[model samples]
Target: MRHEHEPKQRKHTVRNVILTVILVLLVSVGAYAARKYYNIKHAVDNTYQSAGIKKNRNANAVIQAKSPISILIMGTDTGALGRSYKGRTDTMMLITLNPKKDKTTITSIPRDTGVTIPGYESESPSKINAAYAFGSSGTAIKTVQEMLNVPIDFYAVMNMGGMEKVVNAVGGVTITPTLSFSYDGYTFTKGQSAKMNGKKALAYSRMRYSDPDGDYGRQTRQREVIMAIMSKAGSISSLLNKDFLDSVSSQMKTDLTFSDLSAIAQNYLGARKSVSQTHLQGTGQTVNGQSMELMAKSELQRVTNLNRKNLGLDHATTGNIALSVSDASSSSDSSVQSANVNAGN
Candidate 1:
């Protein structure tokens, strides 16, 4: 009986020691993960603006809600001019993502589109890009929401100066030239696909004058470059690179917090698998000697419908939505005047 009791005690002692070791390992791993999470959160919090946006129609929706969302992408020309974080939105795009439908629609707006900016001097109309330079994030978001007649849930202001570095960091991107032309020492033939480095990609996306479609063609190229970058960035190899993430983190200013981005990547990135690009149709005219794109009322309505449909708001009537394309003057009526702004880059 003594020998049997001794064996049982020894076995119990060994089991307790093993349980203790396992508990210690679990605690160590949990601590490491929490530390890493907080470190990333701190870095992203310091990178950009975290202020809550005002007047967002979908402000109630959380990232985990899986609801359809709209984002305004503004590409700024700030990094080169040695200016503050503000500058003209040289490229503007309104993107709608539906995770349920797994679809993404990106509509590129022309930079020179005449739109009234809030807080602008003299109450005169100006290019849509001016919204960023003069009004900052709040003003820019308001200006676009008024123009597109859609609730913009998020806005990202990207500095174009770091675009070259981002491209280089991702190795490079491949694009199919829509037309045969030579620019910035690189010769591209029509219908030929080419792999472009950072400098070449910038030049390719920037060359609008030589294309037959002018700004429209440039918009197409810009979309292509963006898709290419997105494609490369999603690769396993690119995700593993710490340096690439650091490079992009410093260049972007946005209202979306780090958790918001993480939730989007986790849930909605699959929508990127099928992407559709659209452009606003309008005629170019010189207003006060400055070139501006004048979109017709019918075209504006059509664009509004398309964006609304994509946002799962098609059944919701936007009959009250109208753009002041005909009048460059600021209106006294808040409803009529509130809708004035550029959807362009």
Candidate 2:
């Protein structure tokens, strides 16, 4: 009887020890996660900058209500190819997210498209990309609104060079080239899925001249790289790595604060299930030795209608607008626009 009772006590002691260890591990993990969340929140909070523009409705309220919204994505051509100068936005994609329908629409605005910068209305027909260079991101946002007659709720500017760093930060991105080409010491075969590093991803997105579809094809690749990054960045440990955070800190910017971002992520997670990609295919024209993509009035109306419908507005705003920039006619040549500094964790 003594031996049997001793064995029972030993079993109880082992069970208690196991339970204690498990409890300790759970507490440790919870604390670490809390600390990591605090750290990333602080890091993102530091990158916020207001454009000082008036809005029709409260942006935060829209998110809180789980309504659809628009975000202008600008890929600035700075911090790339060893160039340090503030540069024009090389890529502009307008994203509309509708949570109810779980759909996302991306409309690519041509980089060389023409529009009048807000402060310089008399200086009509400046390159749309010049909007940022002349008045920073505010000008760029206003330029898009004025051209499309659609309200832009937020803006995101990413340094093209920093895009490579982000690609690497997420352990690289996987993309299948729709067209076979090579640039910057990288070879891409059509219809092949390749895992691209930072530079290789840049090369894949930046090779416009060789694409059979020209700049439009390049736009598709750019969208592909971006989507890949978004899909991979969330599931990887690099998102919390020190170097990854640093790269994002110096290379990106936006108007959204940490709270705004967190709310959006919580509310809009379903909106990404369906993505429709479209672009403004404009006629390439050389005006005053400057290249331009002339978007027609009808074409403008179509895209605007789509955006408006997604925003729960009427398909109404469409009119004639001369928005092509010429080196031969303007007060100030569009300067290279500085990017906002906000980025994701």
User: Pick by TM-score: which candidate is best?
Assistant: 2
RMSD of each: 16.8, 15.7
lDDT of 1 by residue, 3-44 (tens): 112343333332222111111111122223443555445445
- What TM-score does structure 1 among the candidates reach? 0.74
Candidate that would win on lDDT: 2
User: What tens digits encode model 2's per-residue C-alpha lDDT throughout 87-120?
Assistant: 7787787878788888666677877785556786
* Quality of model 2 by C-alpha lDDT: 0.64
- Return the TM-score for each candidate structure: 0.74, 0.76
Q: Which segments of model 1 are wrong by more than 4 Å?
A: 1-43, 50-53, 58-64, 78-82, 121-123, 174-176, 191-195, 230-234, 270-274, 314-345
For model 1, what is the error of residue 238's alpha carbon versus the real structure, in angstroms, after optimal superposition?
Answer: 1.5
